[model samples]
Target: MAKKKSNVVNLDERKEAKAKASSGNSMMVSIMNMTKRIEELKTEKQKICEMAARTILKALDAKDKYTYGHSMRVTYFSMVLGKELGLNDQEMYDLQLSALFHDIGKIGTPDAVLNKPTRLSDEEFKIMKKHPTESYEILKGFSVFEKVARFAKHHHERYDGRGYPDGLKGEQIPLYSRIILIADTFDAMTSTRVYRKGLPYQTAYDELNEFSGSQFDPELVVKFIRGMKKEQAKKEDKFYIPLMDEMYEKDAA
Candidate 1:
């Protein structure tokens, strides 16, 4: 009888040990599954954001073809400057989106004012200047675009505090905004149109230098000129914009 009782007790101890081990394994599997699910959700969110961005670009394309192309070129130019500044991957991504959408508010501008070949009158210019704020209004509602929207809204701000809208100045201006401003102005000066020939690269560089510290950030202007000169030396006809996932020829600009 004593031997039989000892045998029963050993069996119970073995069974309890096995049960504890099984429960631990099950808990580990659950934890791994939860981690994988979290990664999948993050990927899904990023895809949704990219889809929304493409849709907005399509709308801008329908509204104005020239502005659409201009936005693309601005994005490319901004990336070049971002590289010169040694920005990280995430920083470059944000700057690219900000530049691409900087003039998105122009979609709401009157066609007459947007396409006018000549200079805008004071009143028309006032309406045109409202585009930055309009960009903010359109983008502020989207949580994913919070920073990009703010950068676009302040792209027109001058370094000397004389610019329109919020009038943010100098270092107070967002760094990405300052970079976009340089790219925007460069594209505008260098892009050829039916009415006027694009300025020579040197001429454009000189203009940027002349207005530095007032209309533009002086350090950025220097960096831009240096980077662009190197880019020109490369003489690469084709350029790729990562955000758009497309390649464009320099001549197309």
Candidate 2:
């Protein structure tokens, strides 16, 4: 409590000092100081925003561990493709958030539907399809994730416009959504589950290639495959997640 009060008092003093500095050189220095302080505040705000993001992800993790791990791998794969496509730093950051939250809506799904070992029935599939929109609903509430929510909401939309929620066609879907779908599908295909073994990387790549122009974005699919080949060359069994500040194992874990 005392430290908090002291910080408030220090901020008041700085404001007062700025108001008092009227001389040309003093005013310039005050302006510079204010700019630096503004930058610091922005950094602090971003950290807080990231904390909120991590907290929400923890909720998702607690609800279902498999989904949480899947989300992480999706983010890593999306980032690999993001790099291959030459995404700028800011673009990559937004893509990461989009991938992490893409399946967040699944938390609202029934446990039976989420954890079923076999293929979903037509009725259960309908329930499963609601997740992307649910993801949008949850994430849109956060002011910082406005764009990310939109991206997540459309991650399942197909290139041929046969997907759900909005039925958006090619180039109509957000680019991050396109990139995320590729990653999401890749992880789903390659991640091991209780009912069956995960497909080999080469098999997954072939599936991706076969569906490139229909389910996945044609160009991004190519870039993702190229980037994944480089990832395989590294032979690293783990990948890093920036938001969680932790390392996670690759597929078949």
**Candidate 2 local lDDT, 1-253, one digit each (tens):** 9999999999999888877765667879989999999999887877787788677778878888899999999999999999999999899989999998889898799999998988899999999999999999988887778999999999999999998789999999999999999999999899889888899999999999999899989999889999999999999999998877899999756
Distance (Å) between predicted and true CA of 253, model 2? 3.1
Point to the candidate with the largest lDDT.
Answer: 2
Q: Model 2: runs farther than 4 Å from truth?
A: 1-35
Per-residue error for 215 in candidate 2, Å, reads: 0.7
Query: What TM-score do all the candidates reach, one by one?
Result: 0.86, 0.86
Per-residue CA lDDT of model 1 for 18-78, tens digit only, reads 9999999999999999999998987687668767767877788898777888888888889
RMSD of each: 3.3, 10.6
